[model samples]
Target: MSAETASARLADIQSRIAQATKIAGRRADDVTLIAVSKTHDAAAIQPLIDAGQRVFGENRVQEAAAKWPALKTATHDIRLHLVGQLQSNKAADAVALFDAIHSVDRPSLVAALAKAMAESGKRPDCFIQVNIGNEPQKGGVAVAELPALLAEAQAAGLPIAGLMAVPPFEVDSAPYFALLAKLAREAGLDGLSIGMSDDFEVAVTIGATHVRVGTALFGARA
Candidate 1:
């Protein structure tokens, strides 16, 4: 998309978020927009950045490492977030690069992150991803196992910021968003990193503090 197009898209998304927040009786500042730039090259993403989208999400540590350093050097205000499943081995690299991690799911990852954070003296905010729908292929801690995972993560001194989830597609996402919000509240976490391109407005209405918008902001992946 052209820079103007991307700017318009960003404005539209912001407007929708404003409307959704109003409907929910919440201030627009309560929600953050994470532009998911995974699979999009720096060239493709620059327009969005030019459009003033500072917070971006990437799915892979390697891809982000390949792209963001130079981009960040050129644009100093950029904040990167890892919004995909992370391997324990990549924990240090991820901690070094990202400003937030929205996929802290299991005990092993929690331990790895803690060690990495201590070694690097950098503790990026962490969001526990929960498999709210019990999807077999999804990358989240099972809801049944959430409390245990949270305890382990907290014990490891991870900055437990909130929770993230990708609901089962082809299903009405409202309930899933609501469920995630409910789960976040029950866990005493005020932050909810739920929502995406298709359902983010609904998610904000239901109480998502962060929305991971990819396709809507960048257009479909090639």
Candidate 2:
């Protein structure tokens, strides 16, 4: 996409976020918009960066390592987030690269991340991913097991930022968003990594602190 198109798309999303936040009586700045830039190469992502998007999300650690080192060196203050399921073995790489990791779902990964942080001295903010829909195929701590995982993560000394979830597809997401918010409140966490391109406005209204927007910002993936 061209720089102008990228700016326009980002502006439109920002405007929608503003409207949603206004309707919800929340400040627009309270919601951080993470442009999901997974799969798109540097050439494609540059336009969005030029449009003043500083925060981006990638799905894989390897892909992010491949692209983001150069991108981050070239640009200042760019925050990269890992918005995909992360393996325990990749904990060190993820810790070294991402400013935040939004997929902490299991105790083993928490232990690995804790070890990585101890060795590397880099503590990335972590959001425990909850399998809100309880889909077997999904990668998250089951809702019932959330407390255990959260307790374990806290015990490991990880920087627990908040919770993250992806609700079931083709469903009204408000209830799910509301439930996630409730869980966050109960856990005493303030950050919420819910919402995506399709329903971010709804997520915002329900108190999402971070919305992972992909197609809406980068256009449909190839």
lDDT of 2 by residue, 18-84 (tens): 9999999999999999999999999999999999999999999999999999999999799999999
Point out the worst 10-residue segment of candidate 1 by lDDT. 176-185
**lDDT for every model?**
0.94, 0.96
- Top model number, TM-score: 2
Cα-lDDT of candidate 2: 0.96
Error of 2 at 7 (Å): 0.6
Q: Which residue segments of model 1 deviate by more than 4 Å?
A: none
State the lDDT of candidate 1 residue by residue for 94-169, as single tens digits: 9999999999999899999999999999989999999988989999999989999999999889999999999998
Which stretches of model 2 miss by more than 4 angstroms?
A: none
For candidate 2, the TM-score is 0.99
